[model samples]
Target chain A: MPGGPVNDFLDQVETCVPALRRYARALTRNADLADDLVQDCLERAIARRGLFRPTGSVRAWLFTILLNIYRNSRRAAGRRGETVNLDSVAEPASPAPQPGHIALAELARAIDALPIEQKEVVLLIALEGLPYAEAATILSIPLGTLMSRLGRARSALRLATGVTAEPHLRTVK
Target chain B: MSAVTHDDLMAYADGQLDPGRVGAVEAHLAANPDAASEIALMRRQSDALHALFDPVAAEPVPARLRARRIAAAQRQRRGRSWSWAVAALVLLSLGVGGGWFARPLFEAPAASAVLIADAINAHTVFVAENRHAVEVGRDDSAHLASWLSNRLDTTLGLPDLSAQGFALVGGRLLPGEPQLGGRAAQLMYEDAAGARITIYVTAALPDRQPAAQLASLDGAEAFYWANARITCTVVGTLPAERMQAVSQAVYGQLTDGDVSAPRYRS
Candidate 1:
């Protein structure tokens, strides 16, 4: 019953579940599947707690496991002939676009359409708000590669949302 | 000041630029409206992306995804699998132990039943005794061999099992079933690891039938065979393969010229 360290590990994992779920939802655009992915990631992290290195933060490690599971499942799904479940695709409920904000629904689709590699980098940094270094480490990409992917993703998103012209700002009374 | 690069502009938009370079990038943005607007679009895209997904995090987590629950489920699964492993081992040993004890009842001829039982019993009783494992120690092997040969009324040469890592540990006489022979000689051998094996020898049964049989009795393997000259059972609690090796060697040497004796297998 050496439960102290294991309990601490589970507590740390519990704190990261929300972020994992969010990242997974953004990546898959399917709420149920995203939570399933998060569950799988958490189970794997718990099972292989011994293999976890102490040098990296638990958040980064969890992210790494989540992304790996996500990619592997995608690959398996691809091999099985991708099943696009229309019911499972979560359509973002967005409000009417404000002056400074781009269309959130359009942005969601744009993010989905980006190459998976670029999509991962964009979501890790922009959605998760992880530090550049940590996102780079989690993605196992060089900082330069991360930045370039971010640049490509932003440009792609901007193009997809048709945000080419600056909107005129009306001064409020 | 180093002129801002595209990467620097992107990093600045992302608010990831070094603090020292932030002032320089701000000054560059003030003088450069197009660069400023491009940075603005990147920020808007980031904002839109977050707006699209951040609510997912705010939703209450489902019970199935709880970390403690998952850990508990995994522990339960591991415990069940371990119990299955232990249960399998118990069943396996039961199967082997049952087979080891039930062999004589099913396979052995009535004559071999008594002899193999006697051989294994003698082996178990003597091998455990460190000081008195052999009545006549190997130092008196010549006298012991001849004395047992006279008592059993057969010229019994002590089978050399050194190739299989067992050496002579001398022998003694034991009273045996009168139907087979009134007396038997038990020649003991010991390996470097102190594992002992005994060869139980008796003059041929009344029938003088040439026969060969193997049985696992009481956790010991007894390889029994008879030729015209005598009946010999090599007994040991060694592993099956090692016991087979020692048994094969003894069978080959003891039944050398007895052409009627069948060769041992396993």
Candidate 2:
């Protein structure tokens, strides 16, 4: 096989790796497991390079594969009775922040509590900065469904964070 | 001009609204404190999500996640599989050329095992030979299909796997074990990535019993199935799911109108 397409494909995959790792980490909340997920996703994508069309964005395609692999792993884990303990993982180390800052740990826990559907929708749009159209496409849902999931996820986060007292806290710069 | 909906407010918060509509949404946000507060809370949630996860993208990526390295390793593995196939072919030629001297070394492996080995060996040997991958090319697919069918004495059709991203590279006949059948037809297919797979088919074994087997030898994977009329094995180094998809497509086409045969799978 010629090296040109393979090289190009690898380069495309390389560009998305960091973002993939970030999304995987956000979803799994374990560094090692998240990396493992990314490795598996990359392997699958490379092996199936023939099926990937050049017209579509490689980033979206990689994200789609990553999400599918994540879902399958979660399903397998569910069957095997594996449970993740968010409390057990070491907390992210950040020094005390200014007043009105959202407690990172509280927000993390709130995100973890979201339903998987809403969680995927929220993170794809919010954390990954994907357009609503692309996020909906990646999730294989209608645009309306994507909107509802985002709405519900944000509401759940707001409730769980107990930030109802003052909703207009502009992010602490 | 029109009453702004909740979707419009959320779209504004998500930065997805059209530029022309941005002014209308902003005017509405200023006029309605509740709408403004709702959009603010949504934006805050997005900002919090970013704060929680954006650092991950900046952290040094692990070595295992490097795509170039992964692709290189995969290429190395494919090369290794071909080497093993070549070695197997050398051993098989020894068994054939030396006859009685090497009989013990080649004593009838399981029929499926022999078939899978032959399929993979043929796949490795011919796939690398760009100029002479097959005796007949896909351009003469009609003649190739019929000639192979006549040679094997079983009805065979050219399996179209274009849907699965593989196009038939055509086929050639090869010698086979007398115990099962004296001849086999090796049909090759190539995908856009130039990855090649082969379907090795022959007349059924004497007992004509249905059998299915999946084997991963070296790096290549093989899916073999036998029916009353014919035996088919698909061999490739593709990942399991992709291999399954190609094998499934091949099975569907070749087994058309034959219900007795159990579906072949990976």
Candidate 3:
């Protein structure tokens, strides 16, 4: 019920687009579908500006709306027997060059192989840097469930990538 | 110090552990190398995941993703005319005049407050109708309950208020504030005297916090409460005691022994 100028809402939403696009891209693994999802989310939020509460942070609220739309579309796509094309998944332009680091492509596949529930929890917490409480709220899951999912997801990724500690090489900062 | 648990380890890796607990976790890790290595591995996974996807956040957003442009386009498509704007401005002035007198009371009630107002508004609009008071009538109460339950994404049953001298008159779905689920179901009941009351229900709000509130507008009074399952508001114009009795009956049946239902904020 925090009524405000529409322009202000739009401005806040605009600042969030880059992060939304990033999260969507990680979830969908395809750039075109990711942008499309973000666009749909932005449209929905803009249309329902009056529905947003003034008490909560707009960022968390926007993320919740995005996740809801994402799940609905996924369900619809599932019924139609649609699957994301693995070949279309985009890779990051630059990956960290740490000694004995897991290959970025391999890690991406490991993440994609995670169960949808675990993938959502991991990406929201790891990639979006959302607090556990906020991420749980966005996913509509209890905090305990979110932590468990994160635990299972980290183990699954570690097993998939086969990461073991390599001898530390001192590097200049 | 209490022993560190797996949850604490994960929380520490995620940077969610409180600063006071950081020393304990670090001490535990130093004494336990295996635990230290496991935490290190978790951090590595988080870093690699970031390496794989963080660049996307830095990429230039496409022109189509602009929020302002999308909003403008949406407005153009809706094609709202000027008269509606003029009328809204007039109403805004009237609201300001009335609201100024009650400014202390208008300090922006919580989301439940907004929902109660919406429920009352819906009640007032439809309770006056004769033929179209409800989309699904009492004869189909069973189906009405199921349909609204599905739409609202929560289990709902039609509370039998006959003991309170009101019979199920039917219910209809209405657009609700999206923040409180985008849809609401309004069930109308008419007493033998022809007076009617409505119970407005929506799926639990985002926080799922228990809340209750009462508000009166234009002679209509609404008693609203939200538990973990759903939010229900009973709206009517009956005398205060009669209204309270009806609200209590509806609350008892709908809450299903939720003994800790929060009291309405005055």
Candidate 4:
């Protein structure tokens, strides 16, 4: 059977699933809910495949859909007064923090405390490693606004993790 | 070298600065210890974020999040719904044979014609089956009525057709024309002789003008009527008098409270 265009569209979407999951995990800080969000995003993308423009990248389009769904769910959860499960935040086993290393657990908590908008910017650029232009498009914000948010997010994170002051290193002559 | 701004330092730290500007930013960082320290801290912050969430990307993706699987499931769902109309069309063609001849007693309005065709198609497709005739069986008539009423966004009580020798066989919600409120409810009734009839209903048309038409389509009799509240089509292959009796009964019960309903005439 000739799967053709549909198969190609699905293949492209499949490639972006990992990053979508990663971004969602960082945003929600809960693995199960993060996967649920990804699943919802993928289903919507597949359903509205016709609406997707050929010019935009699939990954960026998927991120836009994922963010819209995330915002909607957050709004609904807010109305229900839902409590987030902090324990669900995946804390990978890491070596003890060195003098300059930000403690992983502390950083995760700091991320949880960041405003939703800033957290999104941080994860898209820092965690997913998307280019500033792509991340800005995904967030539907101008490049200048994205930079400012990233700056504010970095400052908040630095203060939250007590990494605002850097270690003084000897300068090489 | 131009003065190194905060945005420049941030871009350099995030590894996003233009390639040509990188050299200038490095020179500024070398001359300014404080700026250098700030850039290091920003890089570390990015590192720390990756450390926290990168594992989520590296981990094996769950099957549910697989795009192809989701697409396949959605296609199946869409196909199932579309199958109703396709199956109806096929059966309608078989029942009508070559006689695409449809004689209308009155000028069949375009909206009423489509509704009548859909009603007869639904009736032709489901009436032949011994089981799986209705989605919500007659056993749950109360729930069926309320559910169909809620779906159609109007107060839809199950019309009493028992007096006409046909018992309620229950109803199922069907997707309807987008212009006609985009939803339809099909209520099926069966007589002692195993003859089946279906009443298709939808919210009122945009115009909400009252209309009534009787049409012989695809060898089935269809009585269609619309009021301010709703538009209904009753379809069956029963004899002329029996079909008229059943349609009149359904029309009376369904449009009982709607003052705008025009009187149903044979």
Which one is best on TM-score? 4
Query: What TM-score number comes out for model 4?
Result: 0.56
TM-score of each: 0.55, 0.55, 0.54, 0.56
- Give the winner by DockQ: 4
Instruction: Report the Cα lDDT for residue B195, model 1.
Output: 84
TM value for model 2: 0.55
- Candidate 3: list runs displaced more than 4 Å: A1-4, A90-100, A165-173, B80-266
* Model 4, position A15: C-alpha lDDT score: 88
Q: Name the runs in model 1 displaced over 4 angstroms.
A: A1-3, A85-100, A168-173, B80-266
The lowest-lDDT stretch of 10 consecutive residues in candidate 4 chain A is: A164-173
Tens-place lDDT digits, model 3, residues B1-266:
88898989999998999788999999999999878887887887888777777788898767568775566446534532332243234324323233222322322235655576577667757987999999999999889998998898877889999889999999999887766688999999999999999999988777665555565544666677666678898989899778877887887788877524333212
Per-residue CA lDDT of model 4 for A1-173, tens digit only, reads 11356666776898898889888988887888999999889989999999998798999999999999999999999998967778886565878666677888888899989999999998888888889999999998999999999989998988877765455332222
Better by lDDT, candidate 4 or 1: 4
Per-candidate iRMSD: 10.0, 5.4, 7.9, 8.7
The CA lDDT of each predicted structure is 0.76, 0.77, 0.77, 0.77
TM-score of chain A of each: 0.87, 0.87, 0.85, 0.90
Worst 10 residues of 3 chain B by lDDT: B99-108
Candidate 4, position B225, lDDT: 70
Clashing pairs in 3: none
Per-candidate clash tally: 0, 0, 0, 0
DockQ of 1: 0.24
